[model samples]
Target: MLSYSRVILSLFAAVLLAASCSDPTGAIIPDDHSLGWGLALADAVRDSEFPAGVLFMVSCIDVNDEGDPETAIPWQFYYAEVSDSTNVLIVMVQYIGTTNHIWEDSTSIPLGALPDYADAGPWVTAARDSLGSAYSDWEEYALVVKGNEYPEFPVVLNVAVLQFMSPDTTEQLSVILDSDNDNVLGIIQY
Candidate 1:
């Protein structure tokens, strides 16, 4: 079980991510969606904030798919999109300053913030809901592979963990792509 304080943070993150993933039309969560960084955090444990770090948003579109600019996840990473365009907003937040847990693969900064990352683009949220609510409620983040940089490096058939990291914990939303075909996965935090 999680402590009272931990639960509150987790819930807040869940709601934030949920809102981020969705748009004016709605967000989609697949059963086999790739379990990204944030998704796992909400899935396995409860943290007031995630371990500060950087998460990569990767995506590709299916030409004949449904919805405006509908697409499928590539075999590499996933991203949160407010619209069809590549424009996405990765909300950078840090609730605490120090943490014992650090991403093993990445070097940790000595100071500044708990979770930190950057985007190659600017962020723009709904200023005001001219069409009802100025909020997009996305339930899950989408994992899509754009490309495999090393094509000639002996491509081995393996399961690639294309996902977004919370810089804290790997928790919910969903996992659409999987090792096996014909299925997608989704998760929720309460």
Candidate 2:
């Protein structure tokens, strides 16, 4: 038989464990384009203890094929902390249904390779508008901001839109924009 104090302690521990494992899913709004969603994502990243440094990429995954542009979906933000001249600690924040998951990996990357942090909402909207009728068919979108090798520009925003035709077929559209001014640099389909 356990003492009353021991039983109470056990109950408290069990409750804490359950609470930690439970999903906190009620906070995120269902609209990704809203400023609230962006702030919430930023808060999640800060709460997750990941480096809030420059963002390397931001991706919205599994977006609905319907024409609802405001619908929220899973999003991923990637950041890097350069530990040395040739190695970097990559931190990824994945936000899904108001829950944030943090993942870390170490890889080799050039020093001072940090990408500029930009508000991707405007750029995403611009790319969607450029798609015209095809925007409704896109299932995913991603924004990559990084320094480019091209001497003409220091950094560029590469937006990729993906559409799924079937289980085995997928098409991609790449919209390259000038990061400084959000001007369309090029568009390619693949």
Query: Number of the top candidate by lDDT?
Result: 2
Alpha-carbon RMSD, candidate 1: 19.6
Candidate 1: minimum summed lDDT over ten consecutive residues — where? Answer: 119-128
Worst 10-residue stretch by lDDT in candidate 2? 84-93
**How high a TM-score does candidate 1 get?**
0.17
Question: lDDT tens digits, residues 7-72, model 2?
Answer: 999999998787676646533333344323543565456445644344444445443333122344
Instruction: Compare the candidates by TM-score and give the number of the best one.
Output: 2
Q: Taking the tens digit of each residue's C-alpha lDDT, what string does model 1 give over 1-190?
A: 4698899999999988888876544544432222233234321221332332223332322111111112333222222221222322233111111112222232221111111112101111111111123123332223332222223322322111122224343543322222222122222232
Q: Estimate each model's TM-score.
A: 0.17, 0.50
Model 1: residues >4 Å from true position, as ranges?
A: 1-58, 61-141, 145-172, 188-190
